[model samples]
Each structure stands twice: as C-alpha cells, then as structure tokens.
Target: MILCSSTPHSSPETQPSGLYSWPNVFHVPKFTYEAEFELQQRNIEFETNGTYFNPGPKLKGNLLDGLAQEMMKYTNYPKDYQCEEVAAALTRAHPCLGQLGSKTGFWGWKQSLKYKMQNYRTKLRRLGHPEIRVNSLKHKREGQGKAAANIKKARKAEVNYIPLHPKGETIESLENERIALLSEVKKRDNEVLIKAKMENTFYLRRLEIVEQRPMIGEFKNRWPALFEESEVNAEFLRITTKPLQSKFMSQFDQFSDKLIHILKKKGGVKGQRIKNVLAIKDLCDDIDTRRECILKSVAIYLNEDPDSFFKEYLASATEDAERDISSTVMGIYIIRIDRNREPEDVGVVIEGLKVLKNVGSIILGFIMLFGLIYALDLSFPENFKYTFKFCQKIVMNLDGHKLNTKIQQLKIKLFA
Candidate 1:
C-alpha cells in the first residue's frame, strides 16, 4: 500500500510561487503523522519514539521508497546536499527512523535516498518519461561505454529543467510553434503572444539544447528571440526561478562592501595593487565604477588577470582592433563613446561572438551573460571559471554546498 502521498508539508503562506524560491531547507514530506501512527500500529518496540530503532528490512524499504517517490516529484537528480537535507529532515521528524552508529544518524538514510532516487529514475526511463528517458544509457553516444560523465541533468535549481511537452503537444507541434515564434518576435507589441509561445515550446527547446549541444552562434541563430533582453531575463527565470539581473546585482551589492574589506586585509604586493584599484576616484560614489573596481580587486585577489576577462576599446577603433575584441572568449567589452567620458555600453562576448550588446553596466552584463551561459549550456572561460562558479554556488546558492578549494577559500573570507 502507498502509505503516504509524496507531497511536501508546506504552509499556504510559505509555499513558493513562480520558479525562483530557494528550496526549503526543512522539507518535511506530507503525512508524517500518518506514517508515525502506522509505525505505532506495527507494534514496534523501542525505548522512546525519539530513539533510534530499526524498522526491519521490509518496513525500511517501504518507507524509503515512499520518501524517494516524494523527492522525485521535485528533481530526479538531487544534489548531494539536497539528499542530506531531506534525510536530515526525515530523521529529525522521527528520530526512531534514524540509524545508529552514524555521525548524524541519517547518513545511511541519505545514501539510501540517493540510491533509491537513481532506481526510481531507472524505472521512469524504462517507461519512456521524456525527461529521464533522454538521459538513458541507450541514448548515449557510441563509445561512451558507461561513463555517465555527459549526463544532461539540471545543474541549477531548474523546476522545468526538462519537462515533457505540454499536454496534447508533440515535437512537431512544438516545432511549428517555435517557427511561428521567430516571426512573432519581429512583430511590434507581440510580447504577450511571444511569451506564451516560448513557454509552450520550452520542452522542445531543452531537448535540442541537451541532445544537440549546439554552438552558441548556431543556438542563437535558431532561437533569435531568446537573446532579447526581456527574453533573456525570462529564460533565466524559467531556469532558476529568479529574476536574472536583480538576483545577481542584489547579491553582488550585499557582499561588495565586505568583499572589499576582506581584500584590503591581505598583505602583499597584490594586496597593494588591489588597494590601488579600490582607490580610484569616485569608486564609491559611482555604482558602475565601484562594481568595476570590485571585479578587478577580486581578480587580483584570486591571482587572475582582470584584462583577460575585461577589455576596453574606443568606439571608433580600427577594424583589426575590433576584430581582436570579437575573438575574446567569455569577454566583457567596454565601448568608450569618447575618451573623456564614461563608456557608452558594455558588450558580452562569448566564444568570439558578441552575444549581448548595449548592456548598461558591467555587472549587469556579467549576470546577463551568465544567464546566457546557463541557457546555452556553454562552458565558462578557463581563466575565470572559478569566478563564475563562485557566483553560481555562493551568490546564487544553487548547489551552494559543493564548492572547489578556490571558491571555498574565497567564500570563507567573504563571509568571515
């Protein structure tokens, strides 16, 4: 018998809306009380309800299967930290369910949940669930030979990461819709229709992205409407459930002051250089200037060349000079409208192509390009990979617990 449905125990006021609420750290499965009552009816012997007790292999399997089913409702590929959170919540709600001889008493359960989730996905794949089926071994390229490295699961907290087509909508139907959207975007005052059609064809878009892994230029050509400012923000919202520009800028602002102070405390030649960057006139007065200074300081702190990621060129620079800027990988270009005045625009260049132009500020350009990177599944530039990863794991808090050594060190100092 399915003892309990897999819904979460979220209050109406606390329930998330849209795509962006952070995953509740304390997710309790629905019907907790019912499950506890059933356990009591089983006449299990234990010193106390809060004490650890083995539910026997059969009962344990049933309970775990139920939990796995509940979790699969959210994501088939839960990150390690997500599994830990769910397991910890489960054991905390019913301590008797906790395993003895484990550090947190839920370590074993966490492992079981991971395995159970995998098994559940396997079953779904067999049944041809589009989302899971796409990642099946049979679909893998020839000579991959069981390496699982190329699995195209959601890396961020994407709610509709790889959804099935909308009801009654098949691939051909969605393709037709997508083609219609291309012309619709060119029409004036068609934002409403464009938005609806984009939503309708999301499944098809994701299938192509994951299956084909098209080049950035090719993907942009195929989905030209997706690169518009409004749609860029919209697509980001679809993927992460957060407003792209606001979330990034707010997080950057929140940490900017503290990050500067932390960098100031370092004692070395690089530290002096970072201080010099910070000492620029009106750095604190102008938000753009401050943001630029902070970015430069961070690169200096991390021992990376700021010039590698950021470039400045006169608006009337020679064709060869313009060509050099276009060839930059994951680069931000500051176009100086005049030598004596502030830059007129910032452009984001990815894979030697200008993907975003007329961006108002450096930080905004960074976030928008980051959104594009996620949307297009493009790899981060090698020189600044950790920096982007820092923003992904720390600022955005998606898969926040998994951090590399460099990001961990920076995070400690930023938070300390």
Candidate 2:
C-alpha cells in the first residue's frame, strides 16, 4: 500500500497483480482539490477495458490495478482527450474519492495515487521501454558537469599551508599559555553569575535566544508526529491550518474542564475537617496530575513548551498585579532550612499522620498544606491579612539582621 522510491522491485515468482509499465505517460503529481473540484464540475465519465470503470465490482487484486493499467490510455490522447478530461475521467473512476471527507483528504488520496503511478513509470523506464522518456541528463544538467569538473580540478591543484614555528616550539606548546588562560575563563564561566560577568556577549545572546524561542518550535520538538509538516506542501497545508484536528481542540476543552473543577471545588474544606490528613494528601496528588495534564494541553494549544508558558504567565500576572493592583492575594513565606535536608527528616514528623509513609506521600502532604493555607487566605481575608503583614516585617528584619551580622564579622576579620 505504501509507495516510495526505496520500495524494492517485485520478484518474477511473486509479481504484483496487473502492474504495467507503459510509455510516454506521466503521473499527475499536482492533482489536488482544485483539480478534483474542476473535474466534478465537468462531470466526466471514465472508460476502462472498452467499458465504463465501476467501483461497485470488486477488483480481483488491488483497488487501483485497473486505474494504473488503463490511465496511460487516457493520458496518451489516442482520441484527442485533453489533460483535464483525462483527470476528470480518472477522478470519476477513483474508488475512494467520494469517501474523502474534505478537499485535503481528496488531495492526499490523489498524491498517494500519483506516487503509485510514478513508481510504475519508474519500473517500466528501468526495463528500456523506448516510449517512456527517462531524463538521461540528470547528472549532466546545463553547465553543472563543467562546473563540477572545474571545482574538482581546483581542489586537486590547491596546496596545504602549515604555519611555521621555531624548532623548539610545536603548535601545541606555542598555544599552551593562551590555552591555560582560556581554561581558567571556561571554569569561571560554569556558574551563571560568573558567566554573566565573564562572558557578557554570550550571556546576552543566551537571553535573546531564550526570549525569541518560538512556541511552534517547542511543540514540534516535544510532539514531532503531531506537529510534523509535509515537505512537499508544508506551506499551504500544515502552516496555514490551525487547530490541526479535533483531538488537538479536545485537549483544550479537557484543560478548561479541569480548571473549572479546580475553581468550583468544596472538597478542600471537607478534606481539612477529616480526622486523617493522608486522605487529603492522596486527593492533592490526583489533582496535581490533572493540573499537569492541563498545562500540557495549554502548551500544545499555544504551540509552546509548558515551562515557557508557565514563565510567561507568571511574568504577565506579576506585571499586571504591579501595574494596576495595589495588593497581592498570595503570600510567600520563605523559611531557611538546611540546604541538604533529606526526606527522612520530614518522615519522623508525618509518622503521627500515619498517611505519609512514602517519600511521594510526604511531598504531597506539604503541597496540600500550602494549598490549604492559600485557600484559607481567600476564604478568611480579615484574619490572614494582619497575620501575613506581621510575618512579612519579621522576615525583613531577620534578613537585615543576618546581613548586619555578616558585615560585622567581616569587619572584625579584616581589623584583627
């Protein structure tokens, strides 16, 4: 069924059913939607084997065997039938033309037929069929052969030059001092802050590259099959079409439903009142999966990476909140804990809850706890407002004190 240039030739013992190699007949590659529509408007009839071709009678072998064998008769113009007329006749005889749901589907069918017909033509041309004109000048195009020869001669005549160094100094030795300095620079450039200072040009270029990264590029890289474009007609068919299929659009709908459910949930309050906190943690884990799926759906819809979409949303929301809004709804509490804190450290505290034995459950428990705090802030604005303000001041003073202590310690070290 699938036809390509790489397809192997059929063996003599297992030859294809009625595959004929005819001469002076070309396959129609651009027989597209417009051609089909024009043919339909003309309403032409197809004649095969001295009678009208019918799709009703099932062909013994392949569905297109009759068309491929008889197509040359119409194309050769024995009765002076024009190309359009031949196309109309061929379209009328096509088994699946009517079954095609849209113009694109019809065009795709025509393209497939065209490839099959081309393969047949190529097979015949290989057997020295005189009437079929194979392009003998493929490797000898006008001025190309002579230009290639000239390039080859130039390459043969060209000389290699090596830079001369002193007898004691080899190329590597000569560059050793510079290489050492370059290695040091490279080492310094490994960290982000140092790289920004040491390699300003490259750091700025990196920022620009990140900023200009296309949403479509991300989708294509992540889901290549879904976003892949046909090499032949990519401009018209793939690039021009948006929301490529119902499946893609359905993802957006599912995501919207998830967001709506999140907004409408009263389960958070009920789960909070439960004697067991593990039950609430399990629910949050499921909700997290739904949230992740929603993000993926949005990423596909916008033709962007999920990370980029999240970053852009956060940036825009922050901008809007700063520009128009006077206050923030969400409060962030930053607690300085051991940088090397392990899961086992939290496991002891959650042992009483009895629900978070595993590392995953413990992580989910923390997520639920934060989510509960956020939900309560929305529900009880009066209570959390003053509490958050006090916490904010406390954090500010703690940071200032920490900085002052560090400065005092540095002064003592320097003076001593």
Q: What is the C-alpha lDDT of each candidate?
A: 0.75, 0.29
Model 2 Cα lDDT, one tens digit per residue, 168-222: 5443553453233334443632434332322222212222222233333342232
Error of 2 at 43 (Å): 18
Best by lDDT: 1
Total colliding residue pairs, candidate 2 = 1
The CA lDDT at 219 in model 2 is: 23
Give the C-alpha miss distance for residue 392 in model 1, angstroms. Answer: 1.7
Which parts of model 1 are misplaced by more than 4 Å? 1-22, 31-35, 41-51, 147-149, 281-284, 337-340
Clash count per candidate: 2, 1
